[model samples]
Target: MADVRSMCAIGKHGQLGLNGKLPWEGTRAREFREDVQRFFEMTKGHVLLCGPRTRRSIPQFAYADRTIFEIRSSMPPAETIAMFPNRVIYIGGGPPVWSAYASFIRHWDITRLPYDGEADRFFDPAWLCGVRNGN
Candidate 1:
């Protein structure tokens, strides 16, 4: 079986996003660019699982060569993972996706940037508790 992983870049305040875009979008920070590069590098050739909102945010050809599955409310997270047993699956989204699939992620890569910004969305540390106990 392949591994399920999560890669996220947050701000000093645990800010993940604001207004559907990255909180540090206009900050001209090297960390954000590096993080984005790392994400693309790591997720290359891997399956991506994201919710509808995340799917819509991505450009039409952004991940055209790779498999990007739109997670549906009717499908159980476990069942979705099972569909791609031989390939690494990366959970790509914000809090909602993380909260729903926390127990299935085998590894979590979180990068904290030096940005102090306003963000309506944040990454909750408590989400990892399910990963610790469930698997």
Candidate 2:
């Protein structure tokens, strides 16, 4: 079985997005680049799964050397895993995609931002607690 992992940056209130973008806009460009570079390095030579909208939201240069597996709502986690049985798989996107594959995830790398901002999308507090408790 492939090792499944995920990562996301959330706010104090579990906010993940606002108006289709991150709620905060004050992050330095270099910081963003370093974060992206780290993610790419972590999942290098493997598959990264994300929804079409999330995929489109990312800058093209960010994925120049990585293989992205565009996820559809109807695609089963088993099917996606089967496609990359010998590789590490990283899933990073919005709530729907996360919920769909949550059961298959073996590890999560969640970053809590220092401040809360207005958001229409959020990570579930219950889920985060459960994961932290190793439920």
Candidate 3:
């Protein structure tokens, strides 16, 4: 089996996106991007998955083979399991996708940004995931 991981950009108020975009700048934003890049590099050959919106959110994902799952509630779990059966999957999404697959996820790489703004898409605090603040 392959390793599984996920990443997302959240703003100060646990918001994931504002106007369909992440709101972080300067060092925080750069550091988040760099951390994601490192994750992609470390799992170069594995699959990186996300919903359509999440895929759209990322402006320029450097990985050549990033895979989009485009999650559908009607889809069966077996089908989801089949897509990345033996490899680690990294999901970068806003909310819908995160809620859908949180139970199956093994690890989370969340970035804590200053909560000075709001996001239409907010990350659920119920997940209770700890942050490994990146650079």
Candidate 4:
């Protein structure tokens, strides 16, 4: 079986999003771009699993060198994971999708942004600690 991983940027307070977009307007757009490029480089030639909303949020050009599995709310994570054995699958998205696949994920790549902002969505700190503790 492949190793399932999750990646995302979060605020100090665990905020992931605000009003359907990233909460922070990065002072340096290039740095943000570099971060995104690095993410692609790290996950290069691997499959990425994301929900519809996250998929739509991404620009069309961003999919150039990667394969993406669009996971619907109704899909079973185990079934999806089973479909990609011996591969590295990166899960990128919001809380619900994270919760759905939390049990199967073996690693997490969370980027902690420098500042905090108002947010409507958050990544649970407890979940991060649990994953780190191998719960």
The top-ranked prediction according to TM-score is 1
Q: Which scores better on lDDT, 3 or 4?
A: 4
Q: Once model 3 is optimally superposed onto the true structure by TM-score, how far is the C-alpha of residue 107 displaced, in angstroms?
A: 1.1
Candidate 4: tens digits of C-alpha lDDT, residues 4-113: 88788877888887767677744476656666667778777788898877777766766887778799877888898889888889887767777777767778888877
Better of 1 and 4 by TM-score: 1
Count of clashes, each model: 0, 0, 6, 0
TM-score of each: 0.87, 0.81, 0.71, 0.84
Report how far residue 118 has shifted in candidate 4, in Å: 1.3
Candidate of highest lDDT: 1
Tens digits of lDDT, candidate 1, 18-105: 8888788766667778887777788878898988877776666658566888997678888889999889998987677788888788
Clashing residue pairs found in predicted model 4: none
lDDT of 4 at 32: 60
**Residue by residue across 11-97, what tens digits does model 3's lDDT show?**
666766667666553445566667556756655666666666666765565446565455665775346756777676775565665
**lDDT by candidate, in order shown:** 0.80, 0.73, 0.61, 0.75
Evaluate residue 121 in candidate 2 and report its C-alpha lDDT on the 0 to 100 scale: 82
Indicate whether candidate 3 or candidate 4 has the larger TM-score: 4
lDDT of 2 by residue, 1-135 (tens): 468888787778888877777776456656554655576677677678998877877777657766787899788778877888777888877777777777778788876766555888888655543332222
